[model samples]
Target: MPPIRYRVQANGPLRGTAVIQGAKNAALPMIGAALLASSGQTVLRNVPTITDVANAVELARAVGAHVEHHPADRLLIIDASTVTSPLLPGDLTRRFRGSVLFLSSLLYRCGEVIYEGAGGCNLGTRGLDWHYRGLVRLGARIEEKAGTIHITLGATAAADLYLDTPSHTGTENLMIAAATTPGRTVIENAALEPEVVDVARFLTAMGAHIDGAGTGRITVEGVDQLHATDYTVMPDRIDAGVLCMAAGITGGTVQLVGGDVLDAFGVARHKLEQMGVTLRPEGAVTTASRLGDLHPINIITDTHPGFATDLQPPLMALATQASGTSYIRERIHDARYALASELTKLGASIVIEGERATVIGATELRGDTVTAHDLRTGVSLILAGLVAHGETVIENGRMIERGHADLVARLRALGAHISREELPDTTRP
Candidate 1:
C-alpha cells in the first residue's frame, strides 16, 4: 500500500455547515472503561471513526473482549465478559498512547497485567510517574524489568491520590481503578477537562459513584461491581476549534452543527472573537465567520478554562494571516513548536525562543511542500494550505486521520478544495 498525503489548493472563503465528530479524547478512555464491566454489552454511540479508536478496539480484542464496531453509524458495542488475558501485546500497545489506559481494566479483570509501556506522538517527555504513584497508593504492586512492566492488584483498597499536575489520562486511569475497589477514593488537583467529565458520566452510567468531575477535585466511590450500559461520547471541542479556524483563515463563514461550541470552547471562544472571528451560538449549532481584518492576539496554553494546547497549532497557522505579531506560549508540551518550521515552508514568519513563539503576519503566504510532524501540526498545515496563494502538499497526512474523522470530506463540504491521495512508494527497492 502507498503512503497517503494531502493536496490542497487556495480556495475561497469556506462556507456551509460542518457536523463535528465525537471526541477522540473522550471515546478512547470510555472504551477502556467499558472493560470494567464483566457482563452485558456496552453500547457506545457517537464514536468517531479515527485511527486511535481503531487501535483501541484492536487492543480490547487482544485482551479478550468481543468488539463490534459500526463506523458508518458511529457506534461501538463491546462485550468484555470473557476477558481473561493479562498480557497486552507490545505490538498493539505501542501503536498509540491510549494503550496505557487499559491498565486499570486489565488489572481489575485478571488481577495482573504485563505491559510494554505506551507510545504516541513525539511531544516531549510524558512520564507515567503520577499514574504509578496513584496506583501504588491504591494497593497495586508494580515492577519493571528489561523495558516491560508487570502490575498486580490484590484486594483493591481506596486511598487519597494527588497529582503534581492535573494530568488528563492520569485522572481517568485512577478514577477507573478506584471505581470498583470498595471504598471512596479522592483525587486532588484533578484535570477538569470536559472529556474527564464525560468519562465520569459514562462510569456513573455503568454504576460507578463519582462526584466533582469538572472540578479540580474528584471523588470516586468504589462499588462491588460495574455493569454494562449505553452512553454517547461528547463532541470534539478540538475539532470544532479547527473548523472554526478554518473559517477564520479562509475569511469565510461556517456553521458547526451537533453540540454547543460555546460550552465546549470555554476560553477559546473569547480568543477567537479577539482575533476578529465572530462566533454565534444558536442552540446546538454555532456560526463562525471573519468579515473584518484579522488581529494579532497573545495566547498562553494551560489546563481547562484556559487556552488549549491542542488548538495552539491551528491558531498559530491563523496568526500568520493576522496583522502585527501574535505571541504564543506553549506551557503544556515542550516540543510543540515542531510546526514552526513547517509553517515557515508556506511563507509564515515564526520565531521560536524556548517555549515562546512569535508569529509576524499579514505576509502574503505562498503554498509549498510541508511535513505533518504530528496530528495537530498536520491539521495546522492544512489550515495554512486553505489560504495560501498556490498549491500546498502535506506529507504524512495519515497522522491527521488519527484524530479527525472524515476530514477531507468534511472540509470539502465546507467548500474547501482538499483531497487525500496516495504517495508513490519511493522507498521500494
Candidate 2:
C-alpha cells in the first residue's frame, strides 16, 4: 500500500471558523459499550469520522455484530443481537489500543474471549495490569496463552476495584464489565477525563446505574441486561486544543464551533492564555486569536482537570515561536519526548533529559521533511508547518488521521495551506 503524507505550506494569520469533530476517545469505548446490548440497535450520533472508529466498526463485525456507519450524518448503528464470536482478530486489535475495550462486552456476551492483546502508539510501557486486576476482582479469569490472552467470565459478580493510577481506559473497562454484573461495583481512583464521563453517560442511557463518573471514585450497580439506545458523543477537546494552538502559532484568529473551549481545556486554557493566546467562550463557540508575540510558559502533563499529555506535543510546537524558553514535564508518557527530535528537524531548539523537556523559543523554523511517530506528534508537525519558513512535508499522515477527522479540510477552511497526498509504494526491488 502507498504511504500517506501531508504537504503543508507556510500560511500566516489563519483566519476563519472551524467546527470540531466528535471525541475519538469517547466514541471508541462507546462502540464497545454498545455491544453490551443483547438485542436492538445502538445508535451513536456525533461520532468522529476517523480511522480508529472505522477500525472499531470492523472489530465489532468480527465479533458477529451488524454495524452500519453514516459518515454524512456522523451516525453509527450497531446491533450486537447476533454477536456470538469469542475471538478478536489479531490484525485489527494490533492496529489500535481501543480494541482492548471490547474485552468486557465479549466476555459478558459470549462468556469468554480470545484476544491478541492491544496495540497503539509506541508511548513507552502502557501495561494492562490495572484492567486485568479490575476484571479479576469482578470475577473474570484471565490467562496468557502463547502470545494471546484468554479471558473468561462465569456468573460475574461485583467487587471493589482500585487503580494505581487513574487510567482512562482502565476505568472505562471496569465500568463496562461491571455494568451487567450481579452486584454493585466500586472503582477507586477512576479517571476524571471528559471522555470517560461521556462513556459513563452512554452506559447510563443504556440503563447502567453509575455515579461519580467525573470524580476519583465511581460506583456502578450491575443490572441483568443493558438496552440499546441513541447517544451523542461529545466534541473532541484534544482537537479543539490543537486548533486553538494552530491559531496561536500562526498569529491568527479562529472561532471553534461545537464545544466550550474554556471548560473543555481546563488548566490548559489558562496555560494558553499565559502564552498570550486570547480565548473567549460564548456558549458552544470559542474564538481563539493572537494579535501579539507569543510568550513562553511552564507546563506539567497530568491525567484530568490538568494539562493533557496528548496536547503537550502541539504545545511544544507552539513554544518554538515563543519569545523565551518554555519547560514541559511529561508525567504521563515516558517516551513522549520522541517528538523533540522531530521538532529539532524543523530548526527548533529542544533539550530532553528524562521526562523533562526544555524548549527554547524565538528560533527560526525552516520547513523540512519529518516523521509523525504518533497521532499527537503528527498534528504537532502540522502546527509547525503552519508557521515554518517554507514548505513542510509530514510523513506517516495516517497517524494524524487516526484521531482527527477532516483535519486537512478543516485547516484549509481556516486558511492553512495543507493537503494530504498518498505516495506510491516504492519498496519494490
Candidate 3:
C-alpha cells in the first residue's frame, strides 16, 4: 500500500447524520486496564477501528496476552492472564505516547518493567515528569540505565499523590497501580477529561473502588484481584466537534448521531452557540448549522471544562467562515499553531504570535495541496477542504487515520464530495 491522501472538492454542503465512534483516547487507556484483569476474558465494546487501536492490540499481544479485535463489531477481547513480559515493544510503543499507560499494568502485575522515551503528537515537550514523579511517589523505584528507565514496584499501598499538571495518563497509571495494591489511594488535581472518567469506570467494573473520576480529585481503593468483564468505551467528542465544524464550514446542517452534547463538548458547545452557529438539542443527538453569518468570539484553551486544545484545529477551520476577527489563545500547547501555516496555503489569513493566533476570516479560500503534521491538523485541513473552492488534496493521512475512524467514509455519507486514494511515497528515510 502507498501513502494515502484525501481529494476533496466543494460539493455544496455537508447535510446528513453520522454516528460517531468510541473515543480513541478513552479506548487506549481502557485497553491497558484490561491487562490488569488477573483472570477471565476482558471484553471491550464500541472500540474505535483505527490504526492506533490495532497497534495497541499488537502491543498487548507482544506482552504474551491473547488479544482479539472484531472491527465489524467494534469490540476487543484481551486475556492478560497469560501476559509474561515486562519489556514493552519499542517500535509500537513509540508510535503513540499512550503506550506508556501499559506500564501501570506491568508494574501492578509483574512488579517491574523497563521503558524508554515515549512518543505521540509532535506537540513540543509533553513532559512525563508528572507521570514518572507521581509513580515514584507511590513507592515505585525508578532507575535510569542506558537511556531506558527501569521501574520496579516495591510497594503499592499509599495515602495520596498530587499531579501538578493534572496529566490524563498520570491519573490513569496511578489508578491502575492502586487497583490491586491492597489499600486506598487518593489523587489530587486529577485530569477532568471524560476519557479519564471512562477508564476509572472500567476499572470499577473490574471490582476496583473509585470515586470522583470527572472531578479534580479522585480516590481509588485497591482490590485483592481483578477479573475480566465486559466494558463499553465512550463516544468521541473530538469527532463530534469535527463533524459540527464540518457542517459550519460548508454552511449546512449536520446531525451528530450519538454525540454526548453536554458531557463531551462542555465549554465548546456554548462557544459554538455564541458564534451564531445554530445548535438544536435533541437528547444525545444534536443538529448544527449556520444559516446566518457567523460571529467571531474569543477562545482560550486549557484543561477539561475549558476549550480543549484538541478542538482548536477544527475550530480554527470554522473560524475562517466567521465574519470578523477570531481571537484564540493556545495556552495548553506550544506548537499547535503549526496548523495556521498549513491553513494559510488554502488562503486562510492567520497570524501566530507566541501562543496566540489571530484568524482574520470571511476570507475567500481556494483549494490547493496541503500537508498534515499531526492527527488534528489532518482533520483541520479536511475541514478547510469542505468549504474551499476548486480542488484540495491532503498528503500523508497516516496520522489522521491513526486517530479518526472511517473519516472519509463518514464524510462521504454526509453528501460531501471526498475521496481518499493511495499515492506512492515520494520521500525517503
Candidate 4:
C-alpha cells in the first residue's frame, strides 16, 4: 500500500452523527493474551480495523496461533493451544511497541523467547526500562542482542512488582507472565485504565486469580493452565469522545450508541462542558449539544478518571475552535505537540511551554498542506481538515486508517468533505 493523503473540505458546519468503533488499545493486548490459553480458542468481537490490530494479529500468527480475521463481522479468532516458538520476526515487532507484551505470554508458554526492540508511534523515547525491570523482578533471565531482547523464564514463583511509572503494557507483561507461575504476585501503581481492567478480566476468565484491576494495585494468583472462553471487548470510549468532538465542533448533535456513557465518557463530558459542550441524558443514546460560542478551558492529561492522554491530540483540535486560550498539559507523551504545528497551518496559535501547550482559537481557518506525525495526530488533523476553509490535504493518512475504520466514509456520511488519495514517497528521490 502506498502512502495516503486525505483531501478534506467542510460543509456548512458538520451536521450529523458519527458512531464509535471498538477500543483499539483494549483489543490489541487482549488478543495478544489469547496466546496464553492452551485449552480453547479465543474469539474477539468488535475489534477495530487499525494498524495496531494488524500488528497484533501478525504477532499472534508468528507465535503459533491459528489466526482468522472476518472484516465484515469485525471479529478475530486465535487458537494458541498448538502454539510454537517461531522467533518472532524482529522487523515485524519493531512496527508497534505493543509487541513487547508478547514477551510475558511467550516466556510463560515457551520458557525461552527472543524479541526485538519495541516500536510504535515515534513520540520521543518510549524506553522499555520499566518492562524489563518488572520482568527481571519476576525471575526471568534476559539478554539483549543486535536488536533482539531474548528472555528465559527461570523455575520460580511470583514476587511483588512495583511500577515506577504505572506503565500499562509493562504491568500487563508482568501480569501475564505471573499468571502461570506458582504463588501470589502483587502489582502496585498499576495502570487503572478501563483497557487495563479488560486485560485483567480476560486473564481471570482464563483461570488466573486477580483483584483490583481498575485501581492502583492488582494482585494475581498464578494458575496451572488457562482455558479459553468467549469474551466481549469493551467499547471504544476514546473513539466515542473523539467523534463527539467532531459533532460538537461542527454545531451538530450526535448520539453515541451502545457505550457506557457514565463510566467511560463522563469525564470527557465534563471536560467538554467546561468548553461549553452539553450532554443531554438519553439513556443508551446520549445526545451532545454545543453552543456556538466555545470557551477555552484548562486540561491536564493523566491516568484514567482524569482526561485520557490518548484523546489529547483530537481534543487539542477541538480546542482550536474554542473562544479563548486553552491550556493543554500532556503528562504521558510530550512530543504530542506535533499536531500543534499542523493546527498552526490552519490558523491555530499554540505556544508550547515544556509539556503543556497554550492554544488560542482561530475564528476562520484556511486549509493547507499538513503532515500527520502519528495515528491520533493524523486523525486529529483530518478533523481539523473537516472544519477548515478550502481544501485540507493531510499527509501520512495511513496512520489514521490504522486506528479508525472507514474514517473517510464515516465522515462523508456525516456530510463532511473527505477523500483518500495515494501519494508517492518522495524521500527516495
Residue 20 CA error for candidate 3 (Å)?
A: 0.6
Residue-level lDDT tens digits of model 2 in 209-238: 999999999999999999999999999999
Per-residue lDDT tens digits for candidate 3, residues 224-332, read 8888989888889888888888888888889887756556788898898898777787887888897778888899998998998999998998898899999999988
In candidate 1, residue 243 scores what lDDT? 96
Candidate 4 lDDT over 1-429, as tens digits, reads 578988988885655666667888788778777888876778888888777888889888887888898877789988998788837787778788788878778887888888867777888767788788777877888888787788887766788989888777877777787788889999999987888888898888778898888888889888888878678777788777777788777777766665655477646668887777777656656677675787888888887778888788888898888888889999888677889888888888889989989988855778999998888898888778778889998988887877788787777877888999887777675
Clashing pairs in 1: none
Q: Model 2 off-target regions past 4 Å?
A: 426-429
Q: Where is model 1 more than 4 Å wrong at Cα?
A: 424-429
Candidate 2 accuracy as lDDT? 0.93
Q: Rate the local accuracy (lDDT) of all candidates.
A: 0.93, 0.93, 0.86, 0.81
- What would the per-residue lDDT of candidate 1 be over residues 9-111, giving only the tens digit for each residue? 9879999999999999999999999999999999999999999999999999989999999999999999999898999888988778999899998899999
Pairs in steric clash, model 3: none
Give the lDDT of residue 256 in candidate 3: 85
Better of 3 and 4 by lDDT: 3
In model 1, which range of ten residues has the least summed lDDT?
A: 258-267
TM-scores, all models, native as reference: 0.98, 0.98, 0.97, 0.96
Better of 3 and 4 by TM-score: 3
